[model samples]
Target: MKLETIDQVAVIGSGTMGSQIAMVCAIAGYRVVLNDIEESSLEKAKESLEGHMERWIKKERLTEQQVAEAFGRIVYSTFLNDLKDSDLVIEAVVEKLDVKRDIFEKLDQLLPEHAILATNSSTIVSSKIADATFRPVKVCNIHFFNPALVMELVEVVQGPHTSDETAQTAFQFVESIGKLPVLLKKEISGFVANRILGKLMDEALFLYENGYASHEEIDLVVTKALKHPIGPFALMDLTGLDVNYYVRQQRYEESGNEADRPAKTVEEKVNKGELGRKTGKGFYSYT
Candidate 1:
């Protein structure tokens, strides 16, 4: 389908990424439906989105009137049927394969034949989920980095089953929403950015776990020497240790490589429910 044909965008799962994605689409003047299973989650997303837009206004990235108009274009819903009319559906659920496939199967039946289905998963490739749907050609990966409203780079992965038209349209849709898009010709578990970031994280965890250096010192070196905006440990915390842990777990499960398993420290943090800023503690504590 052509990019102009994508007039309505539906985001499944009203979590951090989903809500921000919906806001981004709405800000770009697309009719957006933000769907979640729970009404409480939708309410929280609404409040969090408003707060996020307020910060954008402070940064002069958006105006109050613009944010208001964007909000007006978004519809919050708990029913998946509400997405039947969507031109594109972006699934931003958890990193579980079965869960994603289940959602895709339902979406395949619910959405119109022409609707494009995309996932925001950073680690799980769309090929793993696409087979569950009849329209595998319409399914592709549209991964947005954490804090989607702030991050500029978005990865659009074209799985073997994904049609060229779908991949190109997904790339154009991302650009139309004012973010940079990189098209991946092949499907890899972590795509591009996260693959590089995953290597950095593995080394950082190795150093920290082996007592070569404190996480803080490693972070300091990364920021000062490597010139990275954030250290691997700090970035893990920002994106949630649980998310990192699950991504690693998924990789290990797929490859049967023990080395791909979650770091010892990250597993411990997830066990304790110290996910990240959301939990008030992860690699570091937050207020």
Candidate 2:
């Protein structure tokens, strides 16, 4: 499977990151299948893609013709068998190891032997799920940041069994899509960006929990003083409290470290269904 032969991509999941990733691949002229378990989720993904394309056209980043072409390249499906012809499959489902492994196992049985399998998970490494498939050499992590269409950096991770050819091909694939690619020589739990961001978030949560400062004040200082575009709380809202909580829970489960537990505030917000901007409320109200 040469890079030139990789024209069909399958993105499994229609949530925020998955939808954006599908659009990105389509915009790069690949025929993309965006798969989800529910019809409503696929509809939402199509709507979101339409809005993103419209915004891009309005901003003159993409022409009407380009948007139309990209839109025409995407096919939404609820079945995993629909991805049988894909040359590459990027999984962007929830951050659970079992769920991801289940999907990978199914994909391995369905996709062609040459197809490459990648995950968009931030914390869960590829090695953890590669064993679910017979072709562990083809399994790697291609971590895309939130708002995948907007973010420039993508991490192409190599697991213990990931072959050099797979890593090189994944790197080239990401670069061909007009995004910067950074290779992770070894698989780390959080990779590079999240590890640093996790430290910052941990300290921020600690400060707020210990009553050393208010969440708003801490966020203000980070934005105004540290020159960050958004505060930690605001970022959490954008990323979703549920997402944060779940990722933390997974980390805690793996490490058995008390500090890896989700922050109380985040857990409470997720419990109340105030996920983030998508739900209209989190640390701050969007409604």
Best candidate according to lDDT: 2
For residues 201-262, could you state the per-residue lDDT of candidate 2 as single tens digits? 99999999899999899999999999998899999998888889989999999999998999
Assess every candidate by TM-score. Answer: 0.98, 0.98
Single out the weakest 10-residue window by summed lDDT for candidate 1: 233-242
TM-score of 2: 0.98
Residue 233, model 2, lDDT? 90
> All models: lDDT?
0.93, 0.94
lDDT of 2: 0.94
Backbone clash pairs for candidate 2 read none
